[model samples]
Target: MRTDRELTPAELDAFGAELDALRERTLADLGAADARYIRRVRAAVRLCCTAGRVLLMFGWFPPTWLLGTLLLGLGKILENMELGHNVMHGQYDWMNDPELNGQRYEWDIVGPADFWRHTHNHLHHTYTNVIGRDDDIGYGLLRLFPEQRWKPFYRRQVLWATLQALLFQYAVAVQHVKLDKYFKGRISKDEVRPLQRQMNGKIVRQWAKDYLFFPLLALLIGANALAVLTGNLVANLLRNLWTFAVIFCGHFTEKAAVFPAEVLENESRGHWYLRQLRGSSNLEGGPLFHILTGNLSHQIEHHLYPDIPARRYAEMAREVRQIAARYGQEYNTGRMSRQIATVFRRIWVYRKPQAV
Candidate 1:
């Protein structure tokens, strides 16, 4: 069953040894440094959010309104991507810090922490870009890879991709519940019932905080209720769009591969690492961009070692690239605009397998 993509036994053992060494070195160094780094990032996000909300009180002023809206959007991005996303991945779990505990941490998005962990941390990371296995390929919406059998519905993928960005958080919140699958008989009603309940509670809590309480507070305080609501809407829109762009570019770039699930059955650890490298791409950026993307600019490394603290991705990238070179594997990477353009192109890339 082994395809040419599979490494020889000697190569597999060597590849495993080098990667094991990398992981061991990283694990040994994961301690106070990681805990402090996440805490600092959390503090930064909190400060930005507080400042944005306070500025929004003076939304009647044009300068303050623009700055406040921008800050609010940036703050939400930092919160969801850097602080919450990585923390809930158990990246900082070794610190044993209560607030950063993967199981206990709740993020700012409408998606329940538990549900997100189930879909993202467990499933997406595990299955990656296996054509039939990885739900994240296009989130069951668009055709982002030519390997997926195109249907009549795929003609509207451009529109679907746009709408998915605008409603990204809502889409993510409901992904794990899979009500459609249950209704279609692919999954059991009992299996989805508890998740549906959890998602319902999460929806109420998240929606109430943003769409209800904050606007009400502005009205009570004699601020422009319309402006308050609009500010929140704009902020959420910005977060959704930016997150969609970063995530899409990370996985759907031209150089990334879409594998047949059969190639991955009973896969070994080293081959699993190779599959992740082949199926993921990275964005080129400096520190600020890295922070904004939760260091997922180095997506290939994160895919290979999801549990490693996000802050360490930069250091690991060079080693990862070198190891990949030694193994003669292609490590897909590019600038943000280039990567994103390729993903967009893939929407309509319908072609034979050789064309890809």
Candidate 2:
């Protein structure tokens, strides 16, 4: 079987058509019972994480503020890595209840889902690595190495990519919000609903509770204000760094392909999916890594079927790879350390080409 690059346009189209048919047939064969089980497990994991946060915030078993804050950060990291991503993809909708389905977007527990949907589903899924179009490129920060032509700084150092990843959430959030405003001609009423809804008494109450009430209570109860503040900040920084690093390695690593805008624009769904597989790799082994990182190890499968539960992703990956092999596409995968190293190298040496 010839590789993706070896296939001509006509050959690529033919392969895509066959894969589309196969995907439909496979989805039709999925058992409702299995889907339900997957959903139940997803819900259970989410609930456990939520409970852990509540315990960290309110339980009296441990009086250490630092430990409590660290636990809270860990809880958030676990939820985001596992339940949050799957829920956004609607993988937990086996209940068939509209309310339950919509609960995935309840931002109070999981952060804003709309932002994720816009970036992940609307843009990244469609464009993959299409330079200016794919939001995953630099997560809206520095230019992806392949997209950077004249940035001398990026060409000099890839370790800076790690620094970019450290601040990815803020960069992504700001960029998406601004870009949506710019392209859509104005902010839609729907887009601001989340912020507006939070402007009510709930915001006031949360502000008082988290900032005024909690901190004062901690100080009044004989805890050192400086220690508690420093500890909480450290925990948050560590959590965010870990989360961002994992995400960067998933897409920005060496095995990941960076496509030119022209090529990406002309690609079909099959081509885009194939590109995602080639660009992203599964990190092998480490049961703890799989659990904590949400089995994002089956990244290609997740990209192919974002709505499939993560727990089932590993099993589904084998079948998906078999299909890819039949169609002559190579499935990319590697160890976590190798992937991390690749990310650093790619970031260090990445630069856009000069315009003609």
> Top TM-score: which candidate number?
1
What residue pairs clash in candidate 1, if any at all?
none
* lDDT by residue (tens digit), candidate 2, 109-168: 222466666777678876776676776777544455554455555443445455655654
Task: Kindly report which residue stretches of model 2 are placed more than 4 angstroms away from their true locations once superposed.
Answer: 1-5, 8-14, 25-70, 98-104, 107-111, 152-163, 179-213, 216-231, 264-267, 351-356
Candidate 2 residue pairs in clash (backbone atoms < 3 Å): 145-350, 145-351, 148-351, 148-352, 149-352, 149-353, 157-348, 158-348, 256-279, 257-279
Model 1 lDDT per residue over 182-247, tens place: 777999988988988888898889778877887788889988777777888899999999999999
Candidate 1 worst ten-residue window by lDDT? 347-356
- Measured against the true structure, the TM-scores of the candidates, in listed sequence, are 0.94, 0.74
Error of 1 at 208 (Å): 1.2
In angstroms, the error of model 1 at 356 is 6.9
lDDT leader:
1
